[model samples]
Target: MTEFANPGVGTFAAWDYVVFASIFVISSGIGVFFAIKERKNASSRAFLVGGRQMVCGPVALSLTASFMSAVTVLGCPSEVYCHGASFILFCLAFSFVIIFTAEIFLPVFYRSGITSTYEYLELRFNRVVRVAATIIYILQTILYTGVVVYAPALALNQVTGFNLWGSVFATGIVCTFYCTLGGLKAVVWTDAFQMVVMLLGFLTVLIQGTIELGGRGNMWKIAWNGQRLNIFDFAVDPLRRHTFWTLTVGGTFTWLGIYGVNQSTIQRCISCKSERHAKIALYLNLLGLWVIIVCAVFSGLVMYAFYINCDPWTAGFISTSDQLMPYFVMEILGHLPGLPGLFVACAFSGTLSTVAASINALATVTYEDFVKQCFPNVSDKMSTWISKSLCIVFGIACTSMAVAASLMGGIIQAALSIHGMCGGPMLGLFSLGILFPSANWIGAIGGLAFGVTLSFWPAIGGFIYPASASKTLPLHLSTNGCLPLNISDLLSTQLLNFTSQERERSILAENWYSLSYLYYSPLGCLGSLITGLLISRISGPKHTTIVRPTLIRPVSDLFCFWTDKGRKDNKEKTPSDNDRIIRASAEKELNDVCIQESRKIPSIYIPEQCTHINVLCVKETYF
Candidate 1:
């Protein structure tokens, strides 16, 4: 009955199924091939870090996979549908974060020569700091991957009329199978393929929807008329959503958590051959992010244009607007053979890539930080096998969690809140390890616990005990329904709960829900830093020692010392006269600088004596 549907077929044609099957089979095969190779070159370091030779494409792909999980793919559109232009600003903080990682975090990590980035915490701080950080990351990734995988399964259930379990089961079997088989190598390569598929599937929907909506201009016009095109609301209020300052600062920290501290991202960089290549890989990741974000934003507009007059949620056709994109794809692109298959495959790929990457990274951390640290004599083969086994265990746990968790919240908000809860503290711990030399294990651990508790409080209501009457502010609405002074209280219980009919109607009034996602990271980092310092000061003990200035030198110095430490005898340095003479000569040579000044006058016009005089002046002043 639909204009887009074909006459001969009742639902999807055979070719569409074939196309979908072929893509899945091919992508799976590619993963299997890599798995075989990984098994062949099996070693603890190789399994954990691909022997440190990952190229930009694989690194970029894995980073993209881990970064742009299904939560992102599905949630960005949902945010666009609900908040209009604000989500664009919400997502822009990533650009600056990527820049920070490229210049600051990547160089330090690549130079450290460690398999897990958290090991740097051990080297810089202590075992307790490393363990605490690794534990939080593992916990966050499990929850994060669970939600990510769950969202797409829910989307599949809505569009195809399959049971949610069937969708979950199908996705889990495939993702778990490949990830357990391929290790990090398979995860990275498959992620590259998934990124391509994810972009294509969304763009297909975007193009089809755009065409159906009449044109790109018409789409923007509809959004503009609806007041969804407003990006800047120049109100200097802290409670206001999408402010420039919030986006720049809060957004920066949130991203710093992901790129600078999170293993899911940093592992890819650590896998590269050298820090230079790692930096290159990070920039390429940013460039790809720029393209991917543009595509995602366009897809959002396309959805707006397609559903402008007759919102699907209003008609009771789809349970939620998150279902809007999937419904659009099936209704519009189902007729095109292989396209639906490609689309689903793309969706599955994104979910699987993230799940696999998270599990592998967690497994690596568990083995190194917990297992090996506890049992120092474990053989390389046993450690590697233990990590592989843990990967299987983690995959099973994530799958179980995915099925158990009922629908939570919008993909973007849920992802952000989850990240915010754990990421802020993790970022703080790493920052302390890398930047603050005085941070001891007790301080690091205390700061981490405090940061986690503080960040977790807002997410799961007040921490320890509920806030007292004095601490809690009751909501009073203006005539316009806008609670001007504090919206955090209003948002507390109802964070990201916008699909309800009453809630949607409330959003139409002037009292729109607006909160900054950026503040989560810095708040967490600050929480960790302050708490750690306080704890360290209080728990001053004989065992706690300051890091030597030599040890706290730049990354280059660390590498130089690490590479040559064995050659330098630890015995007392009996400096000979020749040794002192050589040191003096080296110091003088280091300080030497040649200053040059050239006379512009023609040979006939300039005197040789004047040229020599100017040269002496230049040398005396500049050098």
Candidate 2:
């Protein structure tokens, strides 16, 4: 507790640097190991997809690390600090997200055996739809990587007094070095390693902090008294941020965009050794995400208890709420050897995993969609180099985008905003192709355009005219616990301005910019679906005769309720028994070892996650 040189700041120690440096060395070492091991292998597939024989456990860890990012580590706590514990609802929504993605999306992508999920667009519709979705994915990944890279850098810089750009480059360089060296395998393995680092680093702080603030009962009592324990709001108003409805409904759509369709996770899913392994990977990922979210939310409660009376920003101790976690870590964990460094490493581990995942995915889409099309005759030797080069190029681009992210307000909101605005449209595009037989390329492109416009209007408006939110704290923040930093006058003014801030938020709350960000993904997904349907019908949909049955997921097989009746009907429409056998044998040509060709009868495995979400058995027939 007395570790800080001053009341609010702590410095990094020699052991801290030693612990932090190990993360980079080990991460980069993985890349070097894979590069040497596979030197004789002469194809880009090895680089891009681990030869499609990647271990399922690492893929699951990579998926969790890729999606959680530093944003969840840093932002979730800050969110709880300012907005209460409503984020718990958002984490809970992943239960449904994983079920839908694992059962519906994973099967189709694994069966198609495409490197990029966008490639499915061309198979289902046309190249135009594929290109459009690819471009949107690229934009979303770029923006998100920027925010992820910047978040931890900002946190470390605020506490350590290190140059922010220095922290940014350190993260980008190490990530790029590993990713470019070993490709997807390196990225996956490093992500697995970092996942352990993240859990150990973050949880250490939570445990130590909870100890500093007394026992769990006393800690909960403090949070309850301060209103940080508020987790439910049944309000249906879309503009009211973080209500139960908004968190649950809006979070479901957001997770769908991330898990169901995003390239980062999809690449990992499709690269696994078998379909069963991929499904298992996804289930494990959901549990990892849930752990991170719970830790972060409780960490936020811990932060609020410590600063409830002091009001860090009002007292001029920190510039933003995001800094609170880092500052607290420095103060409480700095005295102990390696603890602060562990926390810093934890934050940056999230950045490295996320940035590397994005770099790999960006390279994947570029190689599969653009390079292959533009140069049809490129040699495997040269193409492998091209993919590696693309990783370096994107790694730098993401690093540079961190500058732009600096001005994008809170990292979590900005990252998710990009996800919803761009990812939602792409998710819709994929959903349209996978769900509806009548969908055409023209309609998909039109729908994507509409969805983007609908989602971005509020995002852009909010960027220009940021909305103010009224205070909802049951206990008012006090400066009584704060020591004089010699700015008594400024603190007094901030206290007075609090009411005016709330007033302004109320006025802006009526405008489009004030629309709760949670609604963005749903708006885009639904907009795309409706518009695509309208345009498709108007232009004339192709007959089901032209659509491949494999591309469209059987809806009845997805849910028990739908399957009990739907499977019987689908059987009537399915090809005769002999035709199905012939087609199944032909599809096994992909790889006997890489893909599973099983078509077992329905088996009911009611997972412990939820009651309604059933894990359907892989159908023996391709209905």
What does candidate 1's lDDT look like per residue over 49-87, in tens digits? 878778887788668766877776776776566566555
| Least well predicted 10-residue stretch by lDDT in candidate 1 | 600-609
Candidate 2: minimum summed lDDT over ten consecutive residues — where?
601-610
Show where candidate 1 strays beyond 4 Å.
Answer: 1-11, 236-241, 462-518, 537-623
What's the C-alpha lDDT at position 557 in model 2? 43
Q: Give the clash count for each candidate.
A: 4, 0
| Candidate closest to the true structure, highest lDDT | 2
Q: Report lDDT (CA) for all predictions.
A: 0.65, 0.78
TM-score of each: 0.77, 0.87
Off by over 4 Å in 2: 1-6, 471-475, 485-509, 542-545, 554-623
